[model samples]
Target chain A: MSTLENGTRRSPAIHAPGEREITFGEAIREAIAEEMARDQRIFLIGEDVAAAGSVFKVLVGLLDEFGPERVIDSPISEAGIAGIGVGAAITGMRPIVDIMFGDFTTLVMDQLINQAAKTHYMSGGKLTVPMVLRTTLGASRRSAAQHSQSLHALFSHIPGLKVAMPATPYDAKGLMKSAIRDDNPVVIFEDKMLYQEKGPVPEEEYTLPLGQADVKRSGEDITIVATSSMVYVALEAAEKLDSIGISAELIDPRTTNPLDTGALIQSAQKTSRALVLDEGYSQYGVTGEIASVIADGAFYYLDAPVKRIGAMNVPVPFSPAMEDLTIPNADFVVETAKSLCG
Target chain B: MSETNDTNPSITDLDAEHWLQAYEQMVMIRTFEETANDLYTSARMPGITHLYIGEEAIAVGICEALRQDDYITSTHRGHGHCLAKGAALDKMFAELLGKEAGYCRGKGGSMHIADQETGNLGANGIVGGSAGIATGAGMSIKLRGTDQVSVCFFGDGALGQGLLYESMNMAQLWKLPVIYVCENNQYGEYTHNSKAAAGSMVGRATGFGVHAQAIDGQDIRTVHATARLVIDRARKGGGPAFLVCNTYRFRGHHVGDIDRPYRTREEEAEWAKRDPLTLLEDWLLKSKQAEEHVLERIKQEVKTAVDDAVAFAEEASFPSESEVDQHVYA
Candidate 1:
């Protein structure tokens, strides 16, 4: 398997090691491992992130690699994490704080939205926070409602924060590197299901700039805007739609907060008809944001009304069958695209 | 040798500077608190202000003993702590008036003034928010291998918060460099300290293995002297310390509330007799180090400084509502 040049530890393939590809989970761990080794200023603070290697093993073997001083295990204190991140960031140190799940981010919203977000502007941009918070989203497993959520929309609505949700292992390393080097507070949400989904990644140090959207698949029938884990599902659906004579394009807005609206609008204008897919619940979801953009920017270029496919308006169920019904999958995307084309 | 042999009597050079600077800082704090009261009552200021009027001794006595780079976490009653840490009065007043020149660029009002340059962390409106921050700052200091101390200023009411216990537990476990200064200022807004506080604050501090003390906060000299001993102890690999300063706030919790009704005018009169300014004035004059004219000139200079600060705040611009979109991140 290829290891990024920044001292990224090579991980055993979560899937079969064919083609030496790394999963999204393995890519994140590599990025963290590499960043810590490169900069003495970087450290990790989170609950069970040390001994248990996190609820998802995204931080597995990190404690052994860096020890407790650098790979800290904190009490179950989300507020403490945010508060400590502020102090550590202010004291000329860069900390890559970990919140076990995206929902717990609400508990420390005051520190994230109020303190970390405004601290730079409050200082009139004199002081900047280089702290990185890494969290996991989506519950393809039976982890239940609270544990499985995509709350990037809330963060995107808040100003002065950078958000990176890289879909590919290559993008994960590149975007995480950029997030670490960023002057502003950044939140990176990695999907739990994508942890085992492997892809080809080059063994090189690189960075994906913020506010750029990656055009995963090019087509003319419709532009499908997706994010995080939803990008893969959207691609699968795009391929299915292509067999049915519908040419669908897929664009992944890797960073949610500083959205790649320029890319989204450009592609939406090309295909007049568009479909926004998000893993979050339909209410005020990322789909809503994408729809608003298509309505505002590409309004005149509409052959059909913009459509949005998202999770049901209820919590994700622990039952695997109910979860399949609750969250949008390739079937939902394929159906939505076919209906739009019809 | 017998007369001079006092174990803690040799207040280190920095300690002595701390004492003199405490007095200087106390004067600045007292002037700022009094000026805020004047400006608030006269309607020159727009919002309600929590004047740290009588609690000046607590902030001055504790913060002066800290290194210039050491951190301090403050409460809503934080103007005294901010000024004591050398926050420019112009910026401070500008902040209170919601001007762009304020420490928080008008986003944070009187309750949330912060100057990171002077190591004064922001003043928090939430009662117990600063305690965890103070503990974390202390952890940062210990982790960085510096003798730097972080002092957390909270009221008797905060002693009940989980934040206090959680922070105390961590500070004790890590042997962090922090000082928990509980300004038991007789009242937490409308509640009396005797009614609100369950156990002695010093007892709580000691329960966590933190070196603890109970000091007379009204006496600035006694407060500074004791603070030097404790602050020095922490600076020399000694862990955290907790000092419960038994004090009183002369004004109501905020400008709109009148405290005189809760305690009779006669009761207020009794507390007023122990005014910190009068106490310091007596100490200065009785020692024959200064005359009436000298003290008056100093007070006049403070007045002139206050006047200029007010004028500066008046001229300072207010950040537009659109500017709120800026500075959410770096």
Candidate 2:
């Protein structure tokens, strides 16, 4: 019911009272700054985290505040940076390593998965690597095949590492804080398209738990579980469904690794029709995992088979029109939801 | 071997106690590897192990120069480095046997042994995996403003890995206190270093602006002297340095490798003449730093220790099935 001076209907308010509005990018910067201020042991190491403030500018002004020692600028070596993160984390330091792109995770997979993820477990609990690998995900920015990728599913499939995907500015700040404090390694996948999107985030210190899910809209006809940038698309689809007299509930799973299957099952039980969506490929992705969870937990209560909407199984193209066709949008979600409801 | 008695200050400055201890450490490593080979041949051990037979001096000499608190990253052929860095023989044996009392509680076999209390970060299965970790540890030391230095032990096979150059560049650019020790043990798995490694080993380090030195890895005295100066310089914040220890692996790459078709027996015999343990024993006796009785006593001590470790490993229990899911997260 809240509206701005232009009389346009604002997005549904999700935060508690007295929260201030901020962009997803600003929320990330504030979280890093505040966490760095609180813990001297926490430091940032990556390619352009220092003087450049990162390619996305999500780490703007941190270099001057934390100095060169804490905010380190590494060479263009993902493996080296990730290795340093694991080493520093185990040796009494919390390191937040930034991989400039999610696609580049392939270059550092050995250090990230083989070394960082397995060190604590392989060491029989003698060592703990409290590190955060922050990278950007999602496409449609014309980044082509190399730069743009929503590879959260790959990380979530691994057992030893935690995966967090924050869809809103509020969740962005909160989840980042929790990730820094966690004793295990966490990979945070931020959608590049949502960096400029504005949402309410508290100015005071707060942290959201990594594995919890949030219900963006309470409805009864269908339950739509979405992640990262897809959360907003799902919300828009819900509005369109409301005009057609079909209620669609939206659930945002902040972290994919420790998935909130209980909340997802409860929502599916209420609606009896489930639609799982993601920006990643359809096969062996976040949508498939959610669909499996729903089938296992809410099969008897469901009125229809659980539906999934995902990006087409192909590399993201460079052209905007072609890329848009490959990626799922609000219209695609609405069409999928209507079919599931019928 | 004769050069050990030369008037070089680095070798001459070492006293009788240092020489005796260094000789004993090398003996322990050789005995341990021989026992490991026996265990594998007799089907007592389960997994594959890369024997560090001929490269004992590099581990013993470099570790002798380090303090108890300084850090060191190791590679797959890590048993010698583990022993030299003060890991207990029994626990390492227990680890090889995949017992609950092992360093990793039966999860990690020979390739992943680590003792944090002794400053030995876990050995990596990947060829050049530990370089970044050593560099990061150096960064941590610099940030903490500590005098501690970190050493990274790798093989000639890792020379072509980009992670090494990446880490070395960062270490030099930031003046991180790290010592990169490359044990150039001839063959990388199956290929010779000449075919696999391009240019020169020293050139790889010097190109990164790191002070590099190629030393005789078979000579424990030289290894000890060079490691002492380089480790001390790094601790003093003089920046990172690289040491290319030109060594040879007396055994195959792994337990099952026949080691034929690539290297000839004549080449193996040629390198065997420079066996580190023999060189050290010759130096100890010729220099009159240790008597025959003293040398025999050290051998007896090492054999007893290794025998006790085998017995302990035989008696230790395997982990329960219920605990398989533990330690995946902190």
C-alpha TM-score for every candidate? 0.89, 0.97
lDDT of 2 by residue, A255-323 (tens): 998999999999999999999999999999989999999999999999999998988999989999798
Could you tell me the lDDT of residue A25 within candidate 2?
A: 91
Q: Write the per-residue lDDT of candidate 1 for residues B1-330, one digit (tens) a residue.
A: 001111223333443334445556677778887888888888888889998887777777676666789888888898998988778999999989889988888878898887889898778777767777777677677667788888889888777676677677667766778888888777777877667667666778788788887777777766777788877787777888887877778888898887456666776678788777777778767866567787777677777888899899989998988887776656
For every candidate, what share of the true interface contacts is present?
Answer: 0.40, 0.79
Highest DockQ model number: 2
Taking the tens digit of each residue's C-alpha lDDT, what string does model 1 give over A1-342? 223335443331222434467777787888888888998888888888999998878889999999888888887778767777776776677888899889899877866777777767656666667889888788677888899888887887778788888877878888898898888889998887777656666676767898899888889989999887788778778878989899998888889878888899999899989999888777887889889988789999988899988888888888987987888888889998988889
Q: TM-score for model 1? A: 0.89
Which portions of model 1 miss their true places by more than 4 Å? A1-20, B1-21, B105-107, B186-208, B259-270, B286-292, B318-324
Candidates in order have lDDT scores of 0.79, 0.89
Error of 1 at B140 (Å): 2.8
Each candidate's B-chain TM-score, in sequence, is: 0.92, 0.96
Which residue pairs in candidate 2 collide? none
